[model samples]
Target: MLRATSRLPAGPSGSRGHSRPGRRLRRAVVVTAVWSALVVVAAPGSADADPGLRLSNAAHLAPGVRYETFSVTASHGTAHGHLLTVDLDDARMKIELLRPGTSGAVTGIRAPVSRLADARGAVAAVNGDFFDITEVEHPGVRPTGSTVGPAVADGRPLKAAVPDGQRYGPALVPGATDEDVLGIGADGAARLDRLRLRGAVVTPSGTWELAGFNQYALPVDGIGAYTSAWGPASRARASCGTNDVRAAACGTDPYEVTVHHGRVTSASATLGEGVVPRGSVVLVGREAGARALRRLRIGDPVHVRHRLRATGSVPLAFAIGGYPVLRGGVPLDGLDETAAATRTAAGFSGQGRRLYLLALDSGAEHDDGLTLGELARLLRALGADGAVDLDGGGSSTLVTRPPGAAYSTVRNHPSGVPERPVPNGIGVISSA
Candidate 1:
């Protein structure tokens, strides 16, 4: 019932009903352009596009664990660098501190990255914390900060809490991430938090509040405790030895409380140099800290509380140092403009589901490394919801165990001739 339209044959001229060859080509071009425009308009936003991360090598070391190596050339300067990222799943891997040298010995010494990972059965690891470059007479180096701050390792308090502030920075400021705290719960959940040490000593006259703990040479004015675990070399200026020792002559005024199994055995004005009783907690203080001790009886119980609003979920925690670079997907406002060198940093995304361990290589002469701002931007580009700068420079090192291998190996070059000894390290405990 349908009839086709008729076209006249060309007789030394173009056909009346048919389109000319040049005309046909023009129509086709217009149709193609319209189709292309529609496709572009229908596409997703730039944010939904590929993040542009190109990996040279990527593999799974364990279930939910990914190791990737990538190189990036900056859009700005001739800056380019190599990066190694350890992507860990919170369900399968957990974060922990790896102290330098043997466990429970002097802690601030240099150990190979490979050795720390192997000792802890960590699949991957990175150096942690800024520490005293000043050499100690004993086996280890001192941490740069006065107090070790708040730390929990293997479900035990490693160092008691101190007030939340940089020893050299503002006082009692708690929210700064560069000097903030990090903690992990038993369920492998991780978070950034603020912490401070609070305690009180009870006496017949009144209760004297204690301010800090393990505050060895930190210039902050507060009374605190120093245990035998702090070692014999007192970094405290008022204390006896700086490099070596002689027992106190017994006229000193700092109060020493010797607590044996939760009962106060001895309280003295004389804090003599000696090994702290194996099962004792020694509360040491100066001035007001000593004043409170004068009123306490030998049998009085001492209570020290790390005042945190009972985060029942997080039973384990530790303090690591870094300036907060990114928070809530935005770079923090006022980062320093220091010259870029090798850099090491850590971040987490997807509300703590994925942990990113990053290390950038130091560049050659005339090559400017990433500044703090640049590093922050890089983390954002890599999809970090939160990020912090870790101990870098000569201290920047990353180590990983090859699949099926018994030992781990250092994968990045350290800027130091011999890698610097650090106070602590952060590692991934993949194996029990």
Candidate 2:
């Protein structure tokens, strides 16, 4: 029932087949016929009916790592996607977060997925999280280029999530928070989990709560800590807007304190800029939180402690921001079924033994990308038990290293002509 097509070459332009409207209309009819035949191959009484999805041009990038291109006939139009199937049981395989820079910097710049993969020596990668892509609301403030949710790299906590209202991209589904994340645990398994920031600023007077860490936005009247992991982006935006209203006016009373080697070195009534030196922490507080920090004096002994506490038992080895779409083989209710656009998603199966990274292509002829609900169905049909939606639209991108290749290549048609630079991504690395 599945139609087989000739294998395409391994580059962005070659992966997708383009056609005129007349040819596309003809292909849609053929695709519809193919969909009818899948019912015979589909498991009887299966909740997930085959969605006219076909995989072709498959290749193995490394041991236990397979890459392929897929096309599906949707109501709107025929769509194309790229997929990566990674077997975690392979000792040579590992998944890590792909940020822009390699020197422990977590934000402040964006790069294409292909560039990020080459920098990390990854076999394959997909764009990771929604980010602060623009600064329209807060004029004069630079976009921090930070992800919406928490990020952990090499088992070290890099940053925490911003307030829900301050997050970029589409609205979160009910019951989904900005803290939602997709992570690989120390047990070498992938899972969807929530990570909360547990931190405090201990001063001579008292211990105050730390509500944010290396994030672009902080909760109203809350204290946030920034370290060297946060690059030289200005912290002014952190004080702008409220926790409940992302566009609310900037707070007038902002305070900042610098702690170096366990003691306060400087305190300012205004937020500071530039790189936070290694071993130093900058505490930025707003409103009442700022009032609390104003009590600290230079040379005062201070201790700042912070860590991302996962709801699950196993500690995370790597984690990135994203909201869950499919769980337990079922799509979440209230998922937007109307809006459709290019998307990137990550899913897991076989008790987290296998990970699937998917990115829908965006071309002029076949640009009707899948909706979140439709995307869930496609992932379920592809055998994902649970999946999370990553950054999409122009940010959706997939890159893979052809067998024995020196560098990775972009495999999907990015909506952005020059290829959009993203804040972070999921990287597939192999020792072999």
Candidate 3:
């Protein structure tokens, strides 16, 4: 058995802080876990593993942050992973989205995880949501490089989920939707929740429902709202495909209406590109929705209101795209047990007081990666009560700044030679 320990600082009264609410405070507390090796027998659709799982090189990055690496012997071959354990109860610890630019931009360009961590001054991070990486179906259209699901940062909604059929990652586990997300709530606890887009565009003619917010694809015949958070990506991709068929031909009738300061400023038949100014919204529509937007004339009054309605009582402070893989300490049924591949995942335990970020290594060296089933099992064994799978494969990456390190460095062997540039990642910030 292997034991890893994390030390908690004392509270204002000089007593050790409690890990959860309603718990008694102690003079000191040592958080320890036993990660023993387990051997699994090969099954039809299960990962076979040797008794080699173990955590090593564990280090406390800050008062409430810890980092470690581990290796496992699997059916295909050997695999390795990097892990970050964060205690949300610590006042100096924070989790935020690590996007490309430092100007609060949510999406547009992709960058290496290390660069993103440095830009955000994060102590540790892992790759985030699946995104639109290619645009082969729509010739001449640039991929928007936007995440597949909703994004909320600093308690503000940045984007909403794309259509389930338009998602770019593997098939979601049973009962999971594109709206599923892993986020930290306003109460300072991490949990898995779903965020639905609640929005409307009211015009003199009629009020139209808004189905998307800064997403790469919109449902067929749907209208989407885009703002400055979308950066400079062209809105054309939003109208290029059908909701059920991602590769369908571009819509013949596409319309765009620009609303600034609550009034229509411009309208166009072809989608345009440029940074949307603050207090401005660009509405893109196709087919039936397009016809409705075309009726709006310049200088007409327009009212746009949108919010990401959380399914839970607690409001989310930070959230990113992902699908649930584990719940209530049990791996979800129907998870892919075979077909191992490098992956990224996040989980929470201790009633959301603790969050775990994990990224698997990929390449010729650590070739055998964890299947979705194995990934869930691994997280459960690591003490995760709930977990969500983030983007993986070439996009899988983990970066960290060890003690005395001048800058954060990529820890895992990313499948790509030069780490794959990604839309965003979950960053661990340590104020201490």
The CA-based lDDT of model 3 is what? 0.81
Top-TM-score candidate index? 3
Q: What ranking emerges by TM-score with the best candidate at the front? A: 3, 2, 1
lDDT score, candidate 3, position 111: 94
Cα lDDT of model 1 by residue, 1-432, tens digit: 001122211122111100111111010112112111111112456422332344456656654455666544332333333343433333445677776545432232456666777888888888765443442332333333322344556765555433222222212212452235555555454555544445554444455555544544321213455554554434333222211121212113456677776667887666544445466767665544454455567787665443433234565554454556777777666664445556777776645545667776543542445666667766666656677776677777777776788987666663444555555677877542
Tens digit of per-residue lDDT, candidate 3, span 130-173: 99999998899898889999999999999999877778888877
Alpha carbon deviation, residue 32, candidate 3 (Å):
13
Better of 2 and 3 by TM-score: 3
Task: Give stretches of model 3 more than 4 Å off.
Answer: 1-52, 414-416
Q: Residue 54 CA error for candidate 3 (Å)? A: 0.8
**C-alpha TM-score for every candidate:** 0.69, 0.88, 0.89
Local accuracy of candidate 2 as per-residue lDDT tens digits, 46-86: 42354577888977887778888999866466789999988
Output the TM-score of candidate 3. 0.89
In candidate 2, where is summed lDDT lowest over 10 consecutive residues? 12-21
